[model samples]
Target: MSKMTGAQAVLECLKREGVDVVFGLPGGVLLPLYDAIYQSDIRHILVRHEQGAAHMADGYARATGKVGVCIATSGPGATNLVTGIANAYMDSVPMVAITGQVNTWLIGKDAFQEADITGITLPITKHNYLLRSATDITRVFREAFYIASTGRPGPVLIDLPRDVTVDEVEFSWPEVELSGYHPSVKPHEMQIKKAARALMDSSRPVIYVGGGVRYAGAHRELFELATKINAPVTTTLMGIGCFPEDHPLSLGMLGMHGTKYANYAIQESDLIVAIGARFDDRVTGKISSFAPRAKIVHIDVDPAEVGKNVRVDIPVVGDAKNALHGLLKEVSPKARSEWNEKTETWKKDYPLRYIPDMNVIKPQFVIEKLCEIAPDAIITTEVGQNQMWAAQFFVHKDPSKFISSGGLGTMGYGFPAAIGAKMGRPECDVIDVAGDGSFLMNSQELATAVVNDIPVKVAVLNNGCLGMVRQWQELFFEKRYSATILGRTSPDFVKLAEAYGAVGLRATKPSEVEPVIRAALATDRPVVMDFIVSPAEKVSPMVPAGATLSEILELEWCDVAQSCHLEKIYAEGRKEVLGQEEF
Candidate 1:
């Protein structure tokens, strides 16, 4: 047994666990860890901030379906990682976060840069470890990675004190053999049969998928099941691109800001097969009223989520891909021509339509144009309306093509996530569809893109307001637009892009949208385009909290102006089509 520092032990443990890369920023307490890293085989990516590192790890995990690793020093460094860790937790992305703490002697003395990172992150993590003994390093590291990548995947933290890093320890890697800690991925046979029966029994059925599918590596399984059942599939924000959006059976996304047909289908379905999807409040607004008439067969890796928000007739606890394979074996193929016909009728009737005026360029039209220009580009989005717009308008033809922070709904996620995605697939064109408010959160990372020569296009939907929250207030809170307006006196985004040594363009008119987008695409450098969109625009088919899906408030230009009491013709000369009733 060779003598090694705690930092060395940690690195040895990571190498044993097959971790090849770590995303993080170095700090005072973590100097020894960095020293160890300098002599190690593991590749380290130094992000601009600790938060970005966590997000980068998260993006890598989501894209590759592996345990992503991240490191940060204690106190401020650990705190900065909180948002990204919570984001991964909410989305069920597997990640291991290693942080440095103050010396063991300063545990509770409130020493310089000392903070109880483990305590701070307990709620957001699957599990946390504080290495009090050098010998415990190997075991804890093994356990952390196992916990992170298994069952309902999530971020796990291991906080190591600075003193521990300098201590000598016999280097020995322990093989993972914790029986109690083993997470169960095999669903009970009875429950699996029940889930299959539910699918077989229903005439009008739809598969509602969530991010759990991606975590479970069940995209192919999901596609197979949907094809066999001949049922249309819809995704939550986290589940975007899990099923190819370009597929005829794919219904895009469903919820408050989902496609008109997709939302209507969920509202009217007789049976809902929910896989690896927690019924998030955003996805199932007015929980009691969501899928009012449907029997839900909920399959998730985590059992706690089975009935937490939405009641399930059949709750199957297993990995999504595994459960789908089992269910597919038990269930026989059945025709639902009537159901398919109804969905088709609804799709043809209430198609997602946007009236593009020659005056101001519509955000939806711009997204559609983007789809035309870059059909296979990897699209990431910032939270809020821009995310929903991208989900609705972008035609995703492949699984894992769309990336966004769904559960955390973090605003500053797009730019950094885009960077990670670009790094992951250098050959693919990556774009961050961001709103004005959200873009500013991590726009500083444009330099990261430029310096790395990661040609990611940044499309800013410059509505000059916090679009989603403003829409919510206008609809439900009697138009009390408090702090929602992003007035004209905002930062000059073009100048900001120039500051980062990136190309910037401002497109204010409809005619200029395509040309500017093409120009950005042609450039090898990072490009930012500020598309001045209509601020009066509102996302439609909003089913407010405690309301039924059928009770959707269809938003139109008139509704926008009426709700805000605006005198201007919000959507002048825009055509409207009446929706058809189908089930």
Candidate 2:
């Protein structure tokens, strides 16, 4: 083993793990680490804020399927990374955030810039470390990456004190061996068979997919099982890209803002072959009424998540990939023609549509144009109405094509995430589908993109207010517009983009949406297209808060007949459409 400073050992360990890039900001405490970074071959993208650094890393991990890394200084710097860390954790994105602490001797004394980062990030991180000694640096770095990338991947943090970085130590990479950290990746034979039997027996089966399927990279297996069993597939928001939306069996998304037909299909199904999914509250509105008729067969890597939110008739605790493999072997091909016909009718009855008004731009129209023009772009979204619109309009034909903050629903996440995703896969085009309010939260990242020459395009849905909140208030609170509108105070997005040395374009009319999006996609320099969409436009196919799927609402603008809400099949269609097949 060769002797080196802890800072050098950090770089060496990263090299061993095949890490090529990192996103971070430097401070006084990180001097030694930054010095080592400067001398090393690893590419470091300097970020405007520690939060941007964390999000960029998260985006990088999601795009490349590798553990993304970021670094920051102590106190405020470490604290700035908290939201991003939590975003990654809630979404199960694999990341490792490194922060430099004050000298070890100054540890409980509350030295300047000192804060307990380990304590702050405990709940959000899969695991974290506070370096005890310089000698432990090698193992810490090694284990941090291992933990971050494996077993239902999530963020992990490493706190490096200044003294530890400067200390000299002999570095030797040790084999990772935790006493009780084995993740169940292989499913039990009996459990897989039982799940297979349940799935095969159900007449009306629906596959409910989650982000776990994306993490396990089991889309092929998932596809095979669904096709073999002749089941319709509905995905959660996080599960959007995992299943091909263009496929005949695909039922886009289901839940509060999901497609009406998907929600209908789920409610009518007799069996839910759930794969890598958690029954989040948003996906299961009014829990008692959710899938009231369906028995569940859950396959997941974490045992705790299997029955945490919903009851499971057949539970297979293992990685989604392995479990799917086992199910594929046990189950044979079968055609549920009656169930297929019902899904098609549901799809036709409640298609996602809107009035074609050339007067004002609609967010959904813009997203559809972007998808048509740049079908292969890796799309990331900032939270709000824009997030929902992207989820609804963009047809994700492949896995990893769409990224967003699903659980935490953090605003200001898309732009930086686009930057990180671009860095990880420079060959692919990256676009941030953002709402104006959410875009402004981290708008300063435009400078980061310009300086680094990262040409990540952004489509800003400029509704002139917090669109989602405004919709909620209008519907439920008598339109008492509080701190939502950024009317007169909103900055001119074109000027803002120009000031940051990036190209800016604006589309006010419906006719300009497609051309503007095409222009942004064509530009080599970073471009932000501000589509001045109508604030009056709202996301349809919504199941109101705490309401059952049977009570879904739609806007008259969506249908040619000016329909306000479509009656669910339970009342009039299911029995007639499916020849008396009852759930």
Give the C-alpha miss distance for residue 336 in model 2, angstroms.
3.9
In model 2, the worst 10-residue window by lDDT is 560-569
Q: What would the TM-scores of all predictions be? A: 0.92, 0.95
Residue 433 lDDT (model 1): 95
Q: What is the C-alpha local distance difference test score of each model? A: 0.83, 0.89
Model 1 score (lDDT): 0.83
Clashes of 2: 0
Give a tens-digit lDDT track for model 1, residues 1-583. Answer: 8898988988998888888878888989899999999999997877778888888788777666778888999899999999999998888878999999999988999988888999999999999998888888888998899889988889999999998888899987678887777676988899988888888888889999988887777888888889888889999888887898777788878886777778788988999999888888878878777877889999988888989987888889888888989988988877668889888787788777766677767888889989999988888889998988888888876657788898879998888888777776778888899999999987877876777677889999988779899888877888877777764336778888999999999898988999998999998889999998877677765667666566666667543444233322222211111122221
TM accuracy, model 2: 0.95
Backbone clash pairs for candidate 1 read 286-546
Error of 2 at 302 (Å): 0.8
Which consecutive 10 residues in model 1 have the weakest lDDT in total? 569-578
- Write down the RMSD of candidate 1 (Cα, Å): 6.9
